[model samples]
Target: MAGEHEHRDVSGGWLRAAVFGATDGLVTNSSLIAGVGGGGGAHHTIVLTGMAGLVAGAFSMATGEYISVTTQNEAIHAEVANEKAALAQDPVGEIAELADTYIARGVSPATAKAFATELAASPKDALHVHVQEELGVDAQKLPGAWTAAISSFLSFSLGALLPLLPYLLGLSSLPVALAVSAIALMAAGALAALLTGRSPIQSGLRQLLLGALAVGATYLIGHLLGAHV
Candidate 1:
């Protein structure tokens, strides 16, 4: 039972947000660095471009998370509110709805009806069944928008700094950017996998290789464009 609960926790919305936010930070900032490096941009320019990417990407992630999560929260709240109203006005019908939900989930009709009747004997149990079974929602809980915004903003800025640090220390243009981005991407991948309970080695290698390819491809493009210009 404990192990089952742990697995269920891993599938929650918060974990989803954390993975998505971290990945956004890593990929967007890394790609920005590669694009700037490829364009034959100078060290200062590269740093500045990275800073810009950090800010822009952070804001974008926050806004996107806010809109999406808030929309979900509202929908869930509305459903709970409707359920409460229905329970107040039509307790029998609401009990029947809960039983029907259980029946739909493979329980026999008689067993579902008995289970729902027992659940509805207690008001709290009735609400729990209505919310969990009928609505598929956690009625009392909502994701914190402020928390999401702050985490996203901070994660992007932190990730963006990876590419900019070498250039800040007076390292040569392309090589330093490449090296820093590579290390940062690998680290991010490993961290993501750790959080998601996956194989860190595999995730790290995949992300590192992808980042390398992106930077290498963009660098070549920039070099060619620079030569022509």
Candidate 2:
């Protein structure tokens, strides 16, 4: 039963944001570095570009995560409030609605009513079921926007630093920088794959390919622009 409940749990608000921030920061900053260097830009320019990307990307990820999570939580809370109000004002009707929902989902009429009736015995349980059914949002494990923001900020900064680190440490060659970036991206992807139950090798290769493509496209465009300028 304990193990079964584990699968039913919904959580990881911060973890999701952090992982996103880290992966995005790595890919985005590496691409910027590759693009600048590949275009025959100065080494200093690439370094500076990487730094700028890191700072801007970290802040952007944090702000975006905060707003997104906050808005979602607000909406869910609002719905929960509405459901609670409905239950308080018209519990019988609420029970009927819950019964209808269960019935629609394939429970027999009498069984559904009985189930709803049992649930409605406790107002809290009734509200919980109603919220889950009507809004499809979890009230017990609500997401925290601040947590998301902090995770994004910290993880994105750390990830973006990976590519920039070698450059900062005086490895100025474009090829070397890109090489490090590829390896880093692959490792990150592989690690992330573990969480998703995917093949690490396949996921790593996929991320490496995508990162390479992005760098190549940006490099081509930057090179063209540099030539004209």
Candidate 3:
């Protein structure tokens, strides 16, 4: 047990959805706030814009995640069904193919044939093995569509709420909101880096820089538009 360590389940779709949703939410809301504030918008108007962005963005992310995950699952299921039909129609050929796969992977021909034949004894086992070997996917570990959708929805809401919190609390300070959102963006990046075994400092700076660009561009556009209009 000393040397054995458990690996994180990166296969599930929730991690990607949550990270992307949260990052997008923070950047989008912060940029929206900056743009409106730069455009000489009143506090109440900025708050309203932020709120609308949060709601609309969250729903959009959730809907997109759900549809994407569902479509992927459906495609995987179709492939699995095809594999099942193949196994049923040609058990011998399927087993031979599986054995050849193993032999190609440095397994002895005799052992591969024996192992494939043994696995072929059970329909479920044979199907699972064939599907995994052929498709490189675990039939049992398919990502949940609802799980991804809900994760996206909740994470996006939380991220988008960070910049809006200042206005919601009656602060009406654009600088304070920007500071908070910037910190949050860096923190989210650092956390993601830690999860993925990357350099936290680099990741955090990357997020900060990217968010700054978005905010700056929007703010400049808003300022120019406000001056003209």
> Which candidate number would show the highest TM-score if scored against the true structure?
3
**For each predicted model, how many residue pairs clash, with residues at least 3 apart or on different chains?**
0, 0, 0
TM-score of each: 0.84, 0.92, 0.93
Instruction: Using TM-score as the measure, name the better of candidate 2 and candidate 3.
Output: 3
lDDT of each: 0.74, 0.84, 0.94
Candidate 1 collision pairs: none
For candidate 3, write residues 1-229 as lDDT tens digits: 7999887667757887898899999999999999999999999999999999999999999999999999999999999999999999999999999999999999999999999999989999999999999999998899999999999999999999999999999999999999999999998899778567789998899999999999999999999998888
lDDT of 2 by residue, 51-96 (tens): 9999999999999998998888888888889888989899899888
lDDT of 2 at 76: 85
Q: Model 3: C-alpha RMSD to truth?
A: 1.7
What candidate 3 gets wrong by more than 4 Å, as runs, is 1-3
Supply the TM-score for candidate 2.
0.92
Sort by TM-score, top down from the best? 3, 2, 1
In model 1, the runs with Cα more than 4 Å from the true position are 1-5, 11-19
Weakest 10 consecutive residues of candidate 2 by summed lDDT: 3-12
